[model samples]
Target: MVRGKTQMRRIENATSRQVTFSKRRNGLLKKAFELSVLCDAQVALIVFSPRGKLYKFASSSMQETIQRYRNHRKDVHNTLREQHLQQLKQEAIELMKKIELLEASKRKLLGEDLGSCTCEELQQIQQQLEQSLKRIRERKIQVFKEQIDQLKEKEKSLAAENEMLCEIREKIGQQARQESNEDREMVALTESSENSDVETELFIGPPEGRIKRTLTSLYI
Candidate 1:
């Protein structure tokens, strides 16, 4: 039967755990020494037991190795920082060049800096200007048309208002004329009533009575 793989876990027996710790610690220190001698490499190791016993190894001065590691990390960090700074400076240079190009193009569009332009470039500029002017003219015409349409709508509204006002005025005139006619009819009726209230004496006695009355009226 094939042997099963040993399960790697902590040893619960205190004696067995201590024995394992001693053997592993010594083996690790021996391997570190061999690696340092064979490869001419710096090596440092430190281990602590459960009872706070220290186990340590170093192929060179431990302090010097630790200091050299820290210095190497710092130098690497500075190199990366310098590279990032150079990248930023290069980007800034590229952006400045782009801005200059844009400014030059703007100047050309505005008809400035034409001394370096060839005939073909001049013709291209002229075409661009003409296209721009055409668009401007079209926009202007559209605006004018919109204004005219608005004015027309306003005029229609005013006309409708005027028509409504005229209708109101006509009704008012009709009312005034009807009132005047009614007043005239009332006046005529009053005058006819006053005329009917006058009395004339009969003619038989009227002639003599009328003559006496008339003479009496004249004397009074």
Candidate 2:
């Protein structure tokens, strides 16, 4: 019968866990010692028990070995940091070169620094200028059309306002003419009333005066 592999898990029993720790600690210490003796290599091992007990084995001074490890890690980290810095410097140089080329191209487009341009380069610049001018003219035409539309809208608004004002003026004139006719009719009625208000007094005057006036009229 084949023996089954034991599962590599924590032992739950306290006695079994202590026994396993003791066996493993002795085996590990023996291995470290043999390796150091046979190969003449520095070795360091540290183990902590569940009860906070310390166990250690070292071929050389433990503090010296740990310091050496720390120094080696620091040196490796510094080397990596220097390599990253150099890569960033190279990328910055490349970016600066690109920026300079763009600036030179911009200057050339603005009719500056033309002493080194080839015939083909000049032709390319001319084509770029022509394309730019074409776009600018198109934009100008679009702006002019927008302005004209705006002006037409403003003119329509003014015309509508003028028509409204003319209607108001005509109404005002008609009202004034009606008022004038009413005033003239009132004045005529008042004058006719004054003419009909004559006082006729028929008095019994002296008969001699009447007779004398009658005789004077007959003689005439």
Candidate 2: where are CA atoms >4 Å away? Answer: 1-11, 130-220
lDDT of 1 by residue, 1-220 (tens): 9999866998999999999999999999999999999999999988999899998899999999889989999999999999999999999999999999999888999989999999999999899999999999999999999999999999999999999999999999999999999999999999888777653334346578879988998999
| lDDT for each candidate structure | 0.93, 0.95
| Model 2 lDDT tens row, 1-220 | 9999978999999999999999999999999999999999999999999999999999999999999999999999999999999999999999999999999999999999999999999999999999999999999999999999999999999999999999999999999999999999999999878766643323258989888887998999
Displacement of the residue 69 alpha carbon in candidate 2, Å: 1.1
N/CA/C clash count, model 1: 0
Which RMSD values do the candidates have, in order? 9.9, 10.2
The candidate that achieves the highest TM-score relative to the unseen native structure: 2
> What would the TM-score be for candidate 2 when compared with the true structure?
0.56
Displacement of residue 179 (Cα, Å) in model 2 is 24
> Where is the poorest 10-residue window by lDDT in model 2?
195-204
